[model samples]
Target: MAVPNAASHLDFVVDPEHPDAEPFYAPSKRNYPQAVKGFYRSIKWAALVATLATYYLLPFVRWNRGPGAPGQAVLLDLADRRFYFFFVEIWPQEAYYVAGLLVLAALVLFMMNALAGRVWCGYLCPQTVWTDLFFAVERRFEGDLHARRAREAKGWTFDRAWRLVAKHATWVLIAWWTGGAWVLYFSDAPTLVRALATLQAPAIAYVWIGILTFTTYALAGHMREQVCVYMCPWPRIQAALTDEWALNVTYRTDRGEPRLSLKKSHAARSRGEPAGDCVDCRQCVAVCPTGVDIRDGLQLGCIQCGLCIDACDAVMSKVGRPARLIAYDTDMNVARRAEGKPALRRLVRPRTILYAVAIAAVGSLMLWRLTTRPGGALAIAHDRNPLSVTLADGSIQNGYSALVINRDAAPRTFDLSASGVPGAKLVVEGAPSDGTRVRIQVPGDDTREVRVLLRAAAPSGAATSVPVTFTVVNETSGETATATDRFETPAAN
Candidate 1:
């Protein structure tokens, strides 16, 4: 079977001899990547284990929040409109912190791409990680590439049928597990686990799990390379962002040109004829997850995984040739080597520095905001209808809604006062008030909405609107929060 190169849209070859030979499209074939062992493979294994372990286990970890607060280390509490991550808790009003995290992630990805092309795609992408795991299961059930191919050639036998069944069964199991692990993040893991086990979990949770299971199974098992090659937009974006200085999985064509078989190369060298180091073995292609021929030059299908590098190095060692026939190299370096110039590496270029600075700045800003944020908040809104009421006592009263947020672990009373309105008496709808301030209580880690009325003697020839400051002081800790709104009065005719 011929594996169609994803780099080419047409997947057809033009014959130079005929000049006008009719091109015929070749259909893509399923890739059965052969297993290979080397340094890069070891790194990939370690990364796979670490990432999967984190995903499956992090939800089970607990945090020690005070009583009346959820203790999940990381959770999105939709009911309470709060997001908690360890010691940090974000209210709905603080959504900018989440946006900052997203921005920081993008900046870090850009920096990684500037340093090494598609490194994130190759190593840490969810698609790649899941697909690699699926492939491992397939290999375990059906044997390696050669054995599977041989079995396919012999047609479907009982052995092959059973192996296929086992492979697909394992794939579905893993997909289910992956989906199940994801839902644990949104709730208390142990509680959710018991609910799920007892079949008492929420219908929405089960629906989400089913959706995720189907997606994971279909994408990782069947649409593995297709997702990377056709579905994802990152490859196109990365191509636009990359420059010549970026390190990519590249073939050193200068050293391996005029490819020949080992026996032919040996004879040619004996006759003092030109011969390249590459023995023309297709091991690199066989081991590539996307089945890309690295010798065909850098391609969109090449994920920069460095597996081809490992495969080529092993072959080179066996053939007694110097390694790194394929390596993490820049196009400029390849051109330099071809032109007999010393290869130059510019790791700290302006693009990388800019991305690094952006990541650092965003991360620092989010951290500073989180650390310095106050434990209380206040918001006030002036009533629109009947902005002000004229009482019989010749006083103007403005109605307002005040939301007081207490972020502390203990219940606290707040003294709410109004400023900017001279001789104003502040009153809470249900609470007692002194002439100057109203006292209201808020529960720990909760918000209280209170109707507030500010009354002042109507000034003669007074402005129609006056800016009023609403201040809430915590009676226990003396922490304060304030909001400003306009107190409207009747216009003087």
Candidate 2:
């Protein structure tokens, strides 16, 4: 049997005699999604506006990050090797925060999938948002589905040609702006805008913008649902991750099966025959961006966007039937309803709870680390060659390198000292010594490497190595950091 509401390209026949024969392949057809209006549609519109506004306008939002720091609120300062998001600054060495963020995002995605299948792909994904915007632009220029199809059937006319030209031009313009907005995160937005406008931006920036423009145009304007259907991996992944309890854009077979037209259904009811609420109007298929028939059940092509819900609701209302014939539902609920049992909604099941707990744990750890981390750090490395030199005064001097990091905004003077070696005297290169400790100064938000020497009388033993602790105490804040390395001495000769 032919697939219900199948696209033109998919409407092909296989020989009944040769059941295993491959079906003829046809090129995919272009989709003209009809305009929809409903609760879910309103949600999508709000999400589109909020997301696009944040994307295009956030770079211009400024933050007062001191005099020397970049003022952009959210920036990836490659030159300085820093990621600044509002008050949070990430150094290259502290890359675990980024990893934690990615983990948190993945957990949240899993949780969303566990709660509602492919909700992210439907509402929040960049492809969906841009394609929705593109569709709006297309409707503005080329009219709705019927008008566009009618115009296409009439061959080339001035009306169709002008509309096509205008639509494509607007699509390209939107794609260009999308690309332009992306590059703003890497630099000061106002300055980069001026440079881009005057053609003074770096060649690499222009190259990236051009590449992004081409991709955005191809994916959103032309590819549209093809990207979701073929290119994206999320559908396959979510299929594996989703359980029967996960709510999806499901056609209620219990309510919609044995479908008939409105007039036929009325006559059948008069004859005391059973008839489903579905009128077989196919509005759900018409408004689908991916041209999927939700009544065929949960297929990979169903993005759970709920446009079909909106479309089916409209149709049901017109026929004076109850809404939600196509709705966010579950296979388990469908089976229960089919068995003449009440539907069950297990939104707070084990999998969802696990995902939520993981998200909260990771998010909390990252926040705690970000807020409570120290403003200074220390690292020490013992010299490999000539590990220790025996001076004429019978003192063993161990050469070492110490890196002092100051994460604060002001310069700090740290007192460097050594312990675990009796009678040890610290000597720092290019630093003043106060008999016991050496004073080293590190610039604000920078690291300073200094050569250090630990001189002490060898203990009266055959011990060739001694454990030594290196400590740096910030003079202003009394904050301290420590590193440990072994001090070596020659075996007794």
Candidate 3:
């Protein structure tokens, strides 16, 4: 053995003055969570029912878009490159709406983070939903935690083997149904279901179903908590976004410290000695889905599910003490209670205000743009080969490709007009015009491209390039759309 150093003796001095000394920490142990029932569980059940219903039913809901347009209420028609959501229709050119929706979603998530910890992860995430279903299957076949543990200890038997098979069969069925439901959103659900039953569905559809089935089974059944703890980036982002005032699953250390066994604590109380309310029962840890011990301080693994609170409340009721030993609380409040100070909360902080403002601003902007958008559209692409052509009539000519889009339910006439060069003659190849404007008949919900020729009577104007505007005005609605281009002429060397 080596001789003890003077530094070792100094380490024993009560409360050292050094600020950089690291505290000892132990790695967390894995917990096998037990089942419980309470108010939070009831709320979780309601959420599951609502979310799953909305997801699997909303696609089949129908909307009338008149003739020639798809009737599906919620559809992403990739073939036509259109996204239809009830009353709103998004074209490939209007991808900004999708971006706006994504921004709104992110802001909502941030607002939720500001109000509560990872409540979304525990209650609303798809990982949580599917895993809960898998767990229910496990319980139905293998029994609850106690019976499952006992069965595993007894090893494999005919009864156990058959139950295991049943369990896996049920899991696979649920996973397959999940995969099947996802494909319904892309096509007509009833039609696709019939095709699938007749084994006549597209090969690509079946391939996608198989891929989704495997992924769902592996992720929800096999991976479980590993996805939340090790794979997800949301937890880390939430950690950075969270403030001390944000509510989280917390252990009331102020009321539960100086822990002792139930019998010992009761004995100490009877003798007029100080003893904490905690019975060291470990019930809170036993009920945590992520195997986190709330008593160990606020940690990343805590999903703020409130199951531990239920477990501790049950324990407290049994012991004839007040509940809420483990409950939703804030770090600032916990610290205040520890320091014998009044609790303080600030929900209207800068971060929350910023998120709310951004969400409102983006939502309003998208709504305004959608409401005021014109029914007609125009685009012009100037020919690049020769830049400008010298016609036999001693005039400079510019060629362009013009596209006119009609976004209505009936055929509409649009007057196509161009302006830039004075005394320029305009001609549409496939249609006749009244010199200055052309009448183009555009079909309902369709776009038409036409070749346009612009001839300047002469190059006497002096400029080599000039700005040009192409306008298309719907004759019925008087709605107009304009696109800009440049008129190019040959250089005078």
Candidate 4:
């Protein structure tokens, strides 16, 4: 039998009663995050500047696309059914490219999750960035967290009333600018700006601007963290994707347990007794935007922004303890510490490998298809009402609608011909024929449709179905496109 002291060598906390062993579940309180400076804070600041600049300025950038094309660098011209991004123009038939882009975006999100937990939510998400800006405005007009708290504690005052009004006025201006910037992408920015200044812009523009302004104010100014905690699906999906190795904002209970006041901790240490480093200062909680006590364990409310880390580090520096009581750490490290072993970190996992492979594969496929896509196309549709007609001379005639698309931005002529049936002749209605072929000029960046009649001199006992080929040959470049259709005949055999 093991002695009591020998058994105590194993690292297990003995609870005299079961009351303290229940699972942790605390009702969330509203967090009024205090500002702090650290590496993560600097990163957040840089991201804010970059993202906001891109959003508000990209629509005004110019891209010269020769003549008769919209010059905006990035635009979605709904009136013309065209999406222009620099040199690439997408038409209605290329909507699959947008679907592919969405798939690529999802894969990138998963990869970010596999590598770092909710880094996108912390820094890059529009909600987070906009809320951060609104908070800054609130601080500028109302003062820091404590000042606002004091003002709220007091009764209504004229000074407070004015400050409140000023703050809201600022918020509305920002929200309006945010909404106004969005509509510029759909039309010519300079023309729209002049029209809007003269109060002559389209009614649809005003309607969209009003809708977006209201939503931005409501979501960024009022909803704030509530949007992240209860409204977003990403949190649930992130929870599912996270693994033991992924770093999350966590509390190091091993270094912070048995928390006490600073004086009591010093007294305990003087007597050569064990005392944890944390003095229970509550600085981490005070600075957490989500009001999460990271020491309790990883919680869903934490956006993994590392603000608490900055707060706790400042506290540690003032109290003469090491920093990072709160940090981006893995659960595996926690378990290892509990087991009296060194922590391990692993970022190369199967999930990350899979995401990387998918990104690369899909990217390569898109590039290959874009580079090798056909520059011209031909389509043939046979007439349904009268599939075939027997002329007075006993020759079988078939009517078809032929469409030729010229993708290049240059005027070109194409010769339409028919083959695959012996003595088959082709005639294009409303087109001039040059002896053997019907030649038609197709304007640049457009498609032309022509009615075609195919006459085949065949015996009355011929088969019911015969294969026919219609070919369109570029008169200048000799590039050819062929479409196959069936020539119907009366069953006489």
Please report the candidate that would top TM-score against the real structure: 1
Taking all chains together, each candidate's TM-score versus the true structure is 0.89, 0.87, 0.87, 0.82
Report lDDT per candidate: 0.89, 0.89, 0.84, 0.83
Between candidates 3 and 4, the lDDT winner: 3
TM-score of model 4 vs. true structure: 0.82
**Ten residues in a row with the worst lDDT in model 2?**
1-10
What would the per-residue lDDT of candidate 2 be over residues 1-493, giving only the tens digit for each residue?
Answer: 1234333344456555774666554345788899999999999999999999999999999999787778999999887788999999998778899999999999999999999989999999999999999999999999998888788889999999999999999999998998899999999999999999999999888988898899999999999988998889999999999999999999998888789999999999999999999999999999999989988878888888999999999998998899999989888998889889998999999999999899989999999989987788788998988888899998988899899988898898888888999888888888999748988899988889999988988866778888999988999888888999998886622
State each candidate's clash count: 0, 0, 0, 0
RMSD, each candidate, Å? 4.4, 4.7, 7.2, 9.3
lDDT of 1 by residue, 122-224 (tens): 9999999999999999999999988998998888799999999999999999999999998998889999999999999998889989988999999999989
Q: Considering only N, C-alpha and C atoms within 3 Å, which residue pairs clash in candidate 2?
A: none
Off by over 4 Å in 4: 1-31, 378-404, 414-440, 447-493
Model 3 compared with the native: what TM-score?
A: 0.87
Give lDDT tens digits, candidate 4, residues 63-170: 998667789999999997779888777766668878888899999999888877889998999999998898888888888789988887787888789999998999
Sort every candidate by TM-score, greatest first: 1, 3, 2, 4
**lDDT per residue as tens, model 3, 4-29:** 44354545542467634652322233
